[model samples]
Target: MELLKKNIHMNRQKSQAVMQVTLEEDFNVPDSKADVGSIIQDEAGVKIEDMKVANGQVMVTGAMEVEVLYVADNKERKVHRLTERLPFEEQINMEGAETGDNVQLKWDIEDLSVSLINSRKLSTRALLTFSAAVEEIYDVSAAVEIHGDGEISSLSKNLDMLQLTVQKKDILRIKDEITLASNKPNIQEVLWKSIQLRGTDIRILDGQLDVKGEFFIFVLYAGDDENGTMQWVETALPFAGTVDCSGCSPSMVDDVELSVASVSLEPRPDYDGEERILALEIVLDLDIKLYEEDKVEILEDVYSPAKELKPVTMQQVYESLVMKNFAKCRSSERVRMENNQPRMLQICHSRGDVKIDDTQVVENGLKVEGAVFADILYITSDDTLPFALMHGVVPFSHVIEVPGIDGTCRYSLKTQLEQLSTTMIDSEELEVKVGINLNALVVRVHKEDCIVDMEEAQLDMKKLAELPGIVGYIVQPGDSLWSIAKQYYTTPDRICRLNNLESEDVQAGNKLIIMKTVEITD
Candidate 1:
């Protein structure tokens, strides 16, 4: 055991540490010299050397600067609508993400936009800029819902490390469904009242301000067509779009304003066999922004350091892939049981991490006294079978841009996956929720509906045999059915029926037990 030394806190502060980097001067430009077939020299009709030369080096170096951003997340530590917020979140969901899925993150602009090149000097660039008004947002809105049961893991309970991950590829379908759940009901009356008062045309959009514990929302409003008098309602419906101003002219209308409400995401499981996916939905409240005024959307643009701005890294590429997957994701995944046959299973998971004050021998186990952030990323898949379909290489890497530590400003990347938690959280909440029921899938495999059978069935028997409300038996080193019957609660006949015991002698290693949860009353 590596004895505990002075512990170092990983995520102890939120200070934006700045470092001065000297730019290097020299650079080697790629030689563009190409082979050129030579024509006979005008006089000397001899085979001559090919001559095709390219441009020489042109130094375009300068002090390109950047900042770093790093935040942590655990899928299991789900914050509700009113929960406290983090500055930033480095969440990379492989399957996809839903609207209102709070993306908490800390902006590490320094690292992300600087120090990518090997040297400090600047180089030439075929710079390209995009300065065109987006033609249109043909389709501006969509909703996603992931369904799966979240099993408690031991580490999560004791260590409080929670995580969950959903893969983008597992998203079955990305459908476009528009639902007008409820209206203010008094909107029409308010608009008519404004028209009666002789108001002009109406307009709407969201208004954002840096308010603690506050976010933006949208509302409805109306104005008179003749007099240009503007009026709005006190009540608003949460929607997910900006009020169209193209329809209203600026020559007549002054604009409008209304209250805004914040929105968030919530996930829950629906276990109806009729519905293959876990049960939950994403609700987008669009009518939260005050749109009537001339509002400017802030696109944070910071000049990056020469090193931070470079081609995409594997991590970034993976993140983009997951984002694409989640964007096109449907509610759930369908696992193939019998070749073409599919079955549903639970696929919910959550993950979290912490920066302990002191270094320890093993991960997860807390020392006598430790200071930790316990930041978590709570994630849930759309369904049992869909989550099971998620498969890919999950690994970790490091770069100076997203460095593990920065003076007082340190950054750490984390993945909070509850469904595929190969690395136990080492906490109680995690250990209790680490198991899932693949019995349907198992049955399908046995019935020849599934192509492959379960191999290397590795699980803690203590946690495996007795699933929540289910029941089973433990294999003693040298015990038989008759001895077990005399030792405990049930009788020999009951044990025989419970475990499918054939003969008087029972195997010690294999636990023979009946599961109550898997049993059907009907």
Candidate 2:
């Protein structure tokens, strides 16, 4: 007997590791910039430069970009900006990782603080966390059929499975231009800017993918007027594009994650030769995985009545998608200013980020506990310090509905800040509204014992001769026609024909006759 096998392709995560690092550094003010008096606000971002994988370990090299806005100590008390890059390297221990493995790295800035050490020096510190995962793609060989000259009795089953069809990484670059309004002044120099993406949507189509989103851009710049006063502009820009995804169909399920890898804004001159046009270049990185459902016919068990047959079996693991859902959490809170801090004159801009603290599987759902860290930039009542920053945290606990979820299910969650807005309730208190979006994909893992190959040997003629040619038997519990025939060295068809049975079904305590068949080989 020969075993016919088929290979099923699959993609899974091999191993994952997370590392946290605290970075602290001291930087001196540039000779051209004014001396810093006090810091107002700070922004930070992490960029991965290179990743190297070795035996059982991975090394990640990256840099943190920090921008600080502070008031100068001069008589004018002007707001000045300072920027720096801090390089970092971390080695993570990951078992079963090897060279040329596909590794994905995700980073977050937990906290960033900047303090004024002296009139010319500043101290900066940041807490960062990095998560690394290695993905492996392989094939599982399973027995589907058998081909041989002997009469083989086989049992087959149909299994529902998910097959990985596409696994790749691609980039989409969005280019657009923003022109200053006719009423706004010409740009002299950009001081502080914040860019964030919100309400992003990704759709899978035939041979392509569609992406649509809007990014909020806020820029505080020094105007080219006679007084050189500082001016700010905030606007939301809409972006839409498509990616060419070969072999992708609408029926397939997609698990795609997108992030803004890098962005830049350049000041350009308009038709009148004034710096009115701002050129924007944003790069989006996408990690794509597509799965299609399939039904496979597999050999479950095999036996032979005329010859000795033994099947070799092994265990294989498979994955099935349970659910893919998107959930949203809305929260509103009031932030009160401290007695020592300056009161808010008017709200300018607001930004927030969502951090997941814990996630656990509950009854038919996933419980998510997290907080939103928000920063509000506003004009201050104090004439000496015209601008101020307020920081607040809004804690949230929500349960995402996922039917049939259990401890054995594997899930991945991605969170994003869909909307953030701030309004002044009073001079000392402000109201904050936040909208968070959570995307989750849950899968079930199962193991199955499958027959791979079989070994054959010659039957013993002496033992066969000692056995009786006919016998009477009574059906016992957990008895089947195939099992009874195999136990007596006879075919199920022969037993059914002798008993005049309509089907292979048998009951306990039923009387049956068994006969042995001998095969002669030359």
Q: How many residue pairs clash in each candidate?
A: 120, 0
**lDDT per residue as tens, model 1, 1-522:** 011111111111111212222222223212331111111001000111121111211111122221111111222221111011112111222122233222221111111111113222222222211111101111111111111222110100011101111101000111122222234121111111100001111232222211111111111222223422222222112223233333333222121212211112122222332111111122211211111112111111111111111111111000000000000100112112233212222323222122223422122111111211111122223221111122212222111122122122211222122122322232212222121111000000000011111112223345323444345677788775555543332345656776676765667677776433222222
Candidate 2, 132-233: lDDT as tens digits:
887677787889998888677788887667777877788999999999999989998889988888998988899999999999999888889986787888
Model 1 / residue 244 / CA error / Å:
22
Best by TM-score: 2
Off by over 4 Å in 1: 1-522
Local distance difference test, per candidate?
A: 0.21, 0.87
Q: In the order shown, what is each candidate's alpha-carbon RMSD? A: 33.1, 3.0
